[model samples]
Target chain A: MSGRSRSRQSSSVRISDEQITDLVHKLQQLLPEIRNRHSDKVSAAKVLQETCNYIRSLHREVDDLSERLSELLATSDTAQAAIIRSLLTQ
Target chain B: MANSKSAITLLNSTSSRLCFARTSATFASAPPDQLKRQSRRIKMAAYSSMARVAGRRRAWARALLFRLHTRPRHKTLMRRKRRPSTSSDDMVGKLRRLLPGGETMDVCTLLEETANYIHCLSTQVKVMKAISNHHLSKVN
Candidate 1:
């Protein structure tokens, strides 16, 4: 019985490890900067770092573009600008 | 007969006469000529609006496709100059700091959250680009 329980515990450990690797692989694919490189050379930790940096850059971009859009809308036709504003606020 | 001739002329002419006929038709009991013109204008308006909506949908899809194809302009260079600790624990600590609300998570949970965060950021980028393109196209 002890041997059987130990085997079960080890199987659960293996499963979690598999889950970690699977998620890491998904994160690697999502990152454009890392997707093109030698996949074997990148560690899981490296992928995480790249993802952090990429997300930061994307956030900055969203902020900048939103500011630009509002400035453009301020100058354009009010009717169309209002429509776009409603759509964006959603 | 004169009204019918005028109605035919209205149909052949441009939008100004169409508007004229519609306004005039609404105030009084419209003849078949005026009624035809009004119905035609209503149909055209609906059709044009539908086409505009479809065009916007196509433009958004194109924007997303363009995002997938183009690499981001800013490529960040990662520096290991800070800690240089080769331990996996040190790397995990740094990653936790990088991820939002990540300090309390275990390795598995952290990995899962990272994946979700990455997905959300990419979607945000796609949406921002679509909006910007829409406005620029309108202006130009």
Candidate 2:
């Protein structure tokens, strides 16, 4: 189990733009179902639940973006530091 | 005139000292509960003011983001208008000439833009959390 876990950790998965597009398309399709689910008989509790779910999803997106942003910032910072060090040394 | 001015200064200083003493005495004699309530009120006021400032900053950031988003579109429009007769190849040359520092500047600009976008996103997240908290507090 440890070896299998190590192998999985070693492999990095890259998500393609096409995959994102497909996921977006699937989400768009799912929207109507969500709308239909609460269309006719919308209760306050249901609306609140839906809103909470929506907010949670947004929070997740923000968290993901923040993580990516931090990674990019770190990479750029390191590169910039290396460049500055090299220039100073020279 | 000097005598009148000196008298005026003396009167002003005495009045100010009297007012300060009155205020301090009142504050010192106030009940503990009243003091606590006053402090709470002050704290609440400060918090609300901070929230208002944050909201204003978020609005400013959103406006900046809107400008950033539209800037490229505006640039393209201007490019089309300015060089209707120019070929695509010429456009590249023109852009290179227009942007003085070339690739390094472009990379720096891209990094700055990304940083601004991240700042905007983080501000939005903070605003969202505040809104959710406000809603929850209201419900409770």
Candidate 3:
């Protein structure tokens, strides 16, 4: 009587053993799956934007570099390679 | 008697349809010019508000969804097929449109064309250089 009453009196809010177990167990089951799905979608959008920026930059560099190469090759070679180079230059 | 029967059938089956048709007919009976002006204002407001609220991400997402589902590789195939044809034609169109006043844009055309050509040539050289380097490495 003394131990039980003292413990109960010390804590105004009492959590039953079954209630504590159920709450912790349910939270343990749910949290990781929720974090993963949310993280995955955010990760996908970020990656997509990064890829677009990179591809666009690559395009500009390719166009600029190819134009220069075409000009360089125009006088030197008339092969398909050279023609492409010259064509791009034009 | 037949007319009354048909009217009764219509009334029982489609009071809502009749209402919609009646309402539309009333609007259609309005002055055409007034309806046109009101419709135009509504459309303009709708487009402007949509323009303000729409984010770039939504357009990208829509394009991604479209590419994933409908015409997935069709645009890519069309784009690939288009590349060569459009280059020359694009140059012509760009020049032709720019010089709409009958003045010659030949100089500009020749310049951009030459630039475009050089870029093409250089890219080819790089590709060839890359291939040859790979071959040389293999040989070694």
Question: Which candidate should be chosen as best, given DockQ against the real structure?
Answer: 1
**Candidate 1 positional error at B49, Å:** 27
Best by TM-score: 1
Measure candidate 3: CA RMSD.
31.6
TM-score-sorted candidate list, best first? 1, 2, 3
Ranking by lDDT: 1, 2, 3
- Ten consecutive residues with minimal summed lDDT in candidate 3 chain B? B96-105
Best by lDDT: 1
Q: Candidate 1: which stretches are off by over 4 Å?
A: A1-15, A81-90, B1-89
| Per-prediction TM-score to the true structure, in the order listed | 0.49, 0.22, 0.20
Q: Candidate 2 versus the native: TM-score?
A: 0.22
lDDT per residue as tens, model 1, B1-140: 85334322222231222233234445444555554445444333222222232222232222233332352423221112355656755656766655544565667656766675555445444544565576577677
B112, model 1: CA deviation in Å? Answer: 1.1
lDDT comparison, 2 vs 3, better candidate: 2
What TM-score does each model's chain B reach against the true chain B? 0.36, 0.27, 0.26
Which stretches in model 2 have alpha-carbon errors above 4 Å? A1-38, A77-90, B1-140
TM-score of 3: 0.20
Better of 1 and 3 by DockQ: 1
Overall local distance difference test of candidate 3: 0.31
RMSD of 2: 26.3
Off by over 4 Å in 3: A1-42, A75-90, B1-140
